[model samples]
Target: MEFSNTREFARSMDKEDPLATYKDEFIFPEVNNKKVIYFTGNSLGLQPKSAKKYVDEVMDDWANLAVEGHFYAEKPWWDYHERFSEKLAKVVGAKPPEITVMNTLTVNLHLLMVSFYRPDAKRYKIICEEKAFPSDQYMIASQVKFHGFNPEDAVVEVKKRAGENHFRTEDILKKIEEIGDECALVLFGGVNYYSGQVLDMETITRAGHEIGAKVGWDLAHAVGNIELKLHEWNVDFAAWCSYKYMNSGPGNASGCFINEKYHELKEIPRFEGWWGHSKERRFLMEPEFQPEPDAHAWQISNAPILALAPYLASLDMFEKVGMPALIEKRNKIVAYLEFVLHQIDEEVESDFEIITPSNQNERGTQLSVFLHGEGKELFNYLMKNGVIIDWREPNVIRLAPAPFYCSYEDMYEFGQILKRGILKI
Candidate 1:
């Protein structure tokens, strides 16, 4: 489809957008008595209007029912997390039993590593992308140290070639083959946070398995923004936070995915809690740990209902529109944004370059613009003008036109504001 830099063309596209009505579902921040143009869903999603309603329901239940709310509330607190299974399964493309909502992203990553990252003497190395999210880097390094291995010796990183901004899939596959015998695990972020590159998860999983290693993903950016098939890909395990593309509140509860094949294996080691015990035997308080026969077995505590409530509100929207439909709108809006940026560069004769891959398949909603000469000045200028985008270290501005709330006109207006900022700089 062709794109134009004109405001009227963008407005026309917004009018034709099938998912345009979803804009009203979210509450945006205002600046100078006007709604800001928000494009930071990759960092923090705008809150959905229904989030307040769902959270209020939980508060009411707690107020009215007290301790009996576990069994007597409209939606029982004891099983609050269970309500997300089907909805989250649909979002991540897994069997309902294979998915469970639990602790934060890094905590779940550590828990999953306890079970999957069994590094014996012969196979002690783990392969991951260089410059992974700090939490993941810390988790992998700490886990390697816990197993009595030095991080520098035990962790293998797939890095970009000199002068390149992203890792090539062939290079990653070759690295998996090169470290074949010693690799115990291959863990990577499904969508890289800095460059916004989406990895080839299925191929990575296959290659890791062929090398006799377990494969997992930190799907913090991929979970709600892109289509995933963890079960079909045969991924060993994965985890993600709800606040980014999922549009849940800050520090919300997270979701985890474990292959069903691992469910019935009683020998798998995990840090246990009562919530993970079989539901029938849970209240009986037996001494032995009787794990649930699914992903819930990995849970370390009971659900945080207030945190889970806002997530439910967002998941309901996902269920209503479905991922395919959401992604369809996402692709077009991102392309339009890309087109608008290119036009701004040409008009202003600036050297801003997009570091994120141009291929739609290799990215989600984010476009990481490398501000070659102009630094945070341009970003600050835009922010002052109520154009909300994110700034990373060095000199990159990240903008994500989330499909649910951001409209095509937002992209057009952003481009105009960016051009004005560039001219001033």
Candidate 2:
């Protein structure tokens, strides 16, 4: 797939793209009374046009059916979340019973840790990457402290080589072995939010299990963006938000996966709620807690129908196209974006260092660019000129060419705008 840095070439690629029609499914943001080139699906994805229709159905049910909507609504509010299990299972490569829709990302992380992060005196340490998303860092620290252990002593951070910005798989594996007997859990982000580096989850999971540690992942940035097989990888548990690549609306409900091996283990500790009880016996109001025999047991409350509706809209698109097709377009468009950026560097003599891995297998659609000079000013100039990318602290600009909606022309336009911005600075 050779790429040329020209508008005609970009338009030719777009004309040939199989996923080009998907761009119409979303509503792009307007800047300066014109549609901006959106490249921040890694942060907040553009909204699906069908989202309003889905939410309206729920609203109509509540307005007309009122209390009866719990059982009599179009989709039935009582079991709304259950509808997503099969679709989501396909997305993550798991059994339907192994996946469930529930609370927000970090909230689900804490709930899963309650069951998987059993820190005994002999094996009380946790292994994770340094500079994990701040929420994960906070959650790990709090969980360690909850067990009456100092976070500094119980949490081991695997750092990169002095000059590198991303973690090496070998280094992470060595750290897992180094912490051996004292490790209780090995938790990591499937894709680093800042550097956009995808970790080797299969190897990490196997290594953690050999060392007798429960392994989990925060897949917020990886779920819909990359191919995942949580069950096949033997991942103990995982959680992800739908707002990013999943393209659900802002602050949507999250998805969680619990390995089938843990499904029947009733003795495991969890913060239980009535919603997690067996639905067959829920109305009987039994005094004892009879947990569901699957990942559904993790639910602490009934489904948030409105929040879950938007996700259902997005999942409909995923089910129709499947992940294979989406990933194919992702690789091609990202390659074009990479080529265009390199062309810009050559033209302007800019020292733009791409911090994300060059290998396609080691990343998703995102490329994190470390700007060498006038970073903030150039970033601001791009924003003022109607390009929508994200800026991280210090000096990194993140661009994600989401396959579902982003076009090749957007990539070419971004390159042109980026060159102008750099020259202005």
Candidate 3:
């Protein structure tokens, strides 16, 4: 397809888009009295118009029925979280019994580690990517320290080659083999938050298992943005925030995946509570803790109905638009965005380097551009002119054109705005 930098070309592309009507489903932010071209769905998704109704239902239930709403509301507050399992299982490629919605992202990771990260003195080290998201860095370090191990000795970071912005899979696998006997856990972000690089999870998980290590993924940036087969990948466990690409509101409930094999394990180490107990006898208030034979066994408390409401609303959208449709548009829009960036770079005589992987399979919706010979002023210029984007340090901007709402014309408009800004400023 020959690409053009014209509105007509963009419009023609949008007209042919099967997901074009999805843009109307979201409520966008306005800048200078017009809707801003949003590019931060990788950070926080735009709210679905249906989110209000979901929240309102819960609010009305609480207001009218009070405590009785727990078992009597339209959706039934007690079973609200269960509604997410079937739909979310489809989203992440897991069985309904293998999935659950529970605490926030990092908190879920902490809870899951309680069961998976049991390390002996000889096999005590955890392997993760270098410069992982700071929250993960903190979580792993704190967990290591809690286990009486110095993070310096117990945490192995797989580093990228010098002068390279992205990590090579060979480097990652080699690191695992190098730490073979000492590696106790292998956890990495499925999609790197900074680079938008999709790590090879299935291969990495296989390597980790062969070395007698537990493997998991932090899918915060990957869950809704990329295709995942957690159960088939044989991932022992995984967790993700719903707010990013899931459009479940800010800091909403997170989803979890626990392979079904662990559910029947009688000797597994888990942090259990009444909510994780067998539902048949959970309300009996007995002294014994009989765990649910699935992912819900990891839950420490009951569901947060208020927070989970918006998530269920977004999951409804996912059910309507399956991952196949989402990924199709994701590849198209991201490539079109790259084309526009290169075309603009040529016109402006600017050296723009995209650090995100160019291979479709290795990258998601984000393109992290290093604006050589440009500065934060260009980023500011873009923000003040109705283009919403994320700015990282050292003059890099993350442009994540989420497939559900962002249009091709938005990309063209952004290019024009960028050209004017570059020429003027």
Candidate 4:
């Protein structure tokens, strides 16, 4: 289907967009004296207008109530974490107890690994994507080394067949079948950070269970961008950071999920902390660790209200718009971007292809563009011209038009800037 390459066409789309009013809710960045056409929600989302008020509430509580603010503040600092779980659960399609907001991404990954990566002599290997986010790779390598296992032997890196940019779901299932017996954990990103491919989580989880392996997802790029049924998917555990499509601020809070089935299991080893203790007996200061029955049992420290507040605000917005509606809008906007980009690429016979699958169900809001020439320079040029997408090294550029705020006009503006940027090269 051909799309009109005219400003009037873009205006018409924007006029009919049900969520267009939400554009006013964000604080967009400006580059070189112009409002940036931000297509990088996959990297860092635009801040919500309410983010300031949320932070201010916490600051006000701290300033006025001192340490006693934990139980007495307007939002009640001690129960601050609880305030977010219900809304967050709705966004991710899990029950409240199955989720908890806490720590940075890699930190939570390590904590979850400690509990889930229990390997015996017969089953001691971990399977992950080959070009996973660098931090995930490092965390896995270090965790394996800490267990006295050489990463080269203990970690299995899965990749696409030769000449392919992304891995096929069939290949992943086959690999799981081949190595299931020896695999202790299958830790995969729900949507790959570089490839932007949304794996079949339900199918992947079922395959892992068939092999007696624990299935986990790192949802850093997938959380708000895609619809997830972590509980129904029977995911053993999952972790996500909220700074991306969730539209929470930079370095904002992260969340984790553990299926209710595992919540009752006493033998599942975990790294215990005071926060993970049962709420009824937590203040008793007992020497024994009595863990909570759900994902809260994974918490290691007191809640960070300053960082978490923005997510609460964003999650409320998500609840208002609803995931199904958000995803439907995202599909149309992304399709437009892809269609426009393909038009220009065809004009020049450019050596570029979108590595993210064309199937709507196989991706979220992001499109990973692979460029044939030196990709970094083109990315830099786009940046200088105020097209705010992000670059993943070695030749890929990722663009995500977050549904809540980005508009059809934003996409058109981006196309104009990108086209000019390419022609200059």
Residue-level lDDT of model 2, residues 279-349, one tens digit each, is: 99987989898999999999889899999999999999999999999999999999999999999999999
All candidates' TM-scores? 0.99, 0.99, 0.99, 0.96
- Which regions of candidate 3 are displaced past 4 Å? none
Q: Give the per-residue lDDT of model 4 (tens digit) for 1-425.
A: 45776788888999989999999999888898888888888888999999889989999989999998988999987768887778888888899999998898899999988888988888989999998889999999999889888899999988889998778889889989989699999999999888788989999899999999999999999898899999888898899999998988898888888888888876678888888888788889999988888788887788988888898888889988999899889999999988878877876667788999998988889999988874788898998888887887778898889999889988888778777777888
Clashing pairs in 4: none
Candidate 2 stretches greater than 4 Å from native = none
lDDT for model 4: 0.87
Worst 10-residue lDDT window, candidate 2:
372-381
Q: Which should have the higher lDDT, number 1 or number 4?
A: 1
lDDT of each residue in 1-425, candidate 1, tens digit only: 99999989999999999999989989989988989999999889999999999999999999999989899999999988998999999999999999999989999999999999999999999999999999999999999999999999999999999999998999999999999989999999999999999999999999999999999999999989998999999999999999999999898888999999999998799999999999989999899999999999998788989999999999999999999999999999999999999999999899988999999999998899999999998889999999999999999999999999999999999988998998888
> Each prediction's Cα RMSD?
0.7, 0.7, 0.8, 1.5
Residue 288 lDDT in candidate 2: 90
Estimate the TM-score for candidate 1. Answer: 0.99
Winner by TM-score between candidate 4 and candidate 3: 3
Clashes of 2: 0
Each candidate's number of clashing pairs is 0, 0, 0, 0
